[model samples]
Target: MQAQAFAPRLIAWQALNGRHDLPWQVNDPYRVWLSEIMLQQTQVSSVLEYYPRFVTRFPDVQQLAAAPQEEVLALWSGLGYYSRARNLHRAARMVVDAFGGRFPETREALETLPGVGRSTAAAIAAFAFNARETILDGNVKRVLTRVFGVEGWPGERNVEKALWTLAESLLPEDAASMPAYTQALMDLGATCCTRVRPACTRCPFAADCVAHQQARTAELPAARPKKVQPTRYATLLLACHGGRVLLERRPPAGVWGGLMSLPELPAGELSEAWLAQLGTGEVLPAWPEFVHVFTHFKLVITPQPVEVDALAPRAADDTRQWLTPEAAIEAGVPTPVRRLLEALSSGTLSVSHQIST
Candidate 1:
């Protein structure tokens, strides 16, 4: 139960059992920072698919900062919680503008960057600078809560504060072991002390874990309280002309922030007005209705495909574009939008009903 004993056991166990080959486990802060941001609210398996492509495209802070936001969002299309991608781009600019294209080496400075929080900052500090700092990320939170039998939801401020205190108390005196110690905590929580069906028998802290001793490993880390998510409606205009479709870039905030998507009609607005605004188009048919659930609400999207004879010329802006269906699919669109566009282009869009408007 002593603070000093925790890190050594974790570090020793990590040497033989921890993940050693993750793409972002290197000593470089840029890679570490990118991985941390991507891993937020996303599983390791999903992050693996995007991490390599992202690094290969951007390479470093300077390149990432210099690249267009659309390109960055395109690379990050499928990964949800898109605000993380936006913040990653914004933070890269901050690092370049303030730190001369170098990632800050200290926890305080790192925390000042967009999307990098306390735990993320500590991780970068420990791995990149070899600084003795503690990280209380989700994995570490689970590990610490179970080992010490901390009772209450980790989201609660008091519980979080206590965990942070415990985390700092358990920091290893030897700075050299920071990386292994940090990674060990993450590995243990993710692979062993999982949220469901934890492998308590193989845990190194089994004998000392208060939750295991009390037969309450499953109940120690309390779950977040659930709330009812309200439903919302949207009408997506799949306006097309010959081989191309109309796509619009969303504002830099809100749902699907900064991503390219099919032009949307305002709530309670008729499809005919929107079609007239764009160009002379005939409203063909309605595609199948689908629902996309966000963290706070459910969106019911009604897809109205309009075949345009001509597109009215408007002042050019970065927010609107007309591209071939294939290119639209390749652009940074939400998953649902991508699916509809793909179906539209391939002549496979299922027609559920005809739209006269």
Candidate 2:
């Protein structure tokens, strides 16, 4: 049988038995878009709880557009990659202002919005607008590269272009089923043609997979190039006054921005006088050391505990808030910051000052 004709049947098999009941699965594009954004650099299990809450808060494009940036950022707290939240907020406003509070009707228009990349745009276009297009997310990329036995690492200019072209070529033109078909491919790639291990026996595309036929399934897509990651050091100041902990909101540009976090690196170096100003007492020596890894860098954080009568301007640009341990947790701090706060509150961790080296 020709590959072209068999493709839909393969996907149909997947649709009937493959696609899981994702939170945004129904015909609601706003929910779909929300889930897709949260799913970036995050997992299904992680996204599950966040997705429903996001939709409940925003519900539609108009609601998201009208929301305050802080509220949006707060809703997006745990999901890292703060820029995605910012962009989603920006895009929502744009959609409301430019598109009459409606999600763009087509992939091209959707792509013009902030944070909506090609695959994301394609998804919105298909699942939302029922456009006949294919989406090549990471899962789809792996599945396509392995099934067709395409070569070269992903993102290589020619290889990526070829993948996109192949993706377009495989998409069924029938508008009625295009949306389901697109999602079906994603479902198959995520569930069956998985990264660590593939379930060939259950995969509908197995019979026609070129790599599988040749016993080269694992070797089809060339391994990606790797580079060494650099490490950086930072200082975090933990302050407590009368059962309240000091938490500062990060600026909206870098990592964990807009989330409530520890007062960090208030100045070039901590001084005894500077410590006396943040709360009711004096600055103590740096005590605990913690290491955390982000996507691009490893951070070694040295925590300093300071007590003062009233929180002051630790630096030219720092604002301080005092809250109970439970209140701080509800204030949108990321995992690392929240974890540290929890440890401090539970007496499992203690406060001190600067690591000499």
Candidate 3:
């Protein structure tokens, strides 16, 4: 097969072979961007349900921009990587303000928007505007690395640069066919050139794949040495009274920030003084420990569920709230907090809760 004919060949192959039923596949930029954001570090099956519900709630940029941050964060709960939701909302506001409520057309301007990084920008530009920009998402990176036998861990700066160059050079055609070609490349990578157990016999590019030719397909995409994820131990104080739970909004900067969660003691341990700071009375025995894991850190929350008489209600600030258990669920607490509440509602506080940990 001639290199010059690769573009048409791939497109032809994809027109017949590509998966077209994805939630974002109908040539809609808004859906594409939304799905892309959610799909980051998340799988497609997971995003399928989230994508439709989110779009229905906030169908367009303007609607998304206007929705309350708490509601938006609530919708995005459980889809770990909360920053993506925050960035999506922030970018929506910017689009409404700067671009007349429409996502930008070109990759250059789209990249300027919040959360619209290079790969996402390229995807929107190509998939939305038919602009001939190349995307280097994880799937494409693996496909390209394996197809061309590029031997380097893509996490390295130099390796990433080389991969981007390879991606740009591999453009299927010009801007006109970019929408189809972009989708084709992504589809091929996702379904056929997968990380493990690729469908080599069914892949159109198998004959041309250097990794396949050398029987090194599985090893073509070199793995970067794993970094030891740190373990963080913290104490969470869960206080409830009269069917209401006490939660504080995380300051809009740290983990789970801008989202209401069960108030915590100091990062290390729960002390009587900390409970006093919460204006609480005598605390009973400590609740069973629960754990929540994030990308960079693992949190061990030693909870102290204090039964209180009442809590003065107010917005998330230095103060806390006395929300009904169900209302607390709607207030965007972290998964662990929700689990703790579940334990309380179920009258099983002694049971340890493990979530994403």
**What is the lDDT of every predicted structure here?**
0.87, 0.78, 0.81
| TM-score, cand. 1 | 0.64
Candidate 1 segments exceeding 4 Å error: 226-357
Predicted candidate 3 versus true structure: per-residue lDDT over 1-357, tens digit per residue: 355566787788789999877778867788888887888888888998788899899988889999888999999999998988888888888989988987889889988987789998998888888887898988888888888888889999999999998888778656788888888888888888888989989888788889898889878799987787798787777777777777777788888888888876656566767566556555778876766778887787887877765464465554477787778888778888887777777787585544443
Q: Name the Cα RMSD for model 1.
A: 15.3
Task: Give the lowest summed-lDDT range of ten residues in model 3.
Answer: 310-319
Q: Which candidate would rank higher by TM-score, 1 or 2?
A: 1
TM-score of each: 0.64, 0.62, 0.63
TM-score between model 3 and native: 0.63
Instruction: For residues 41-71, write the lDDT of model 1, one tens digit per residue.
Output: 8899999999999999999999999999999
* Per-candidate total of colliding backbone pairs: 0, 12, 0
Q: How does candidate 1 score on lDDT?
A: 0.87
After superposition, which runs of candidate 3 have C-alpha atoms over 4 Å from their true positions? 1-3, 226-357
Better of 1 and 3 by lDDT: 1
For residue 94, model 3's alpha carbon misses the true position, in angstroms, by 0.6
**Best-matching candidate per TM-score:** 1
TM-score of 2: 0.62
Residue 133, candidate 2: C-alpha displacement in angstroms? 1.5
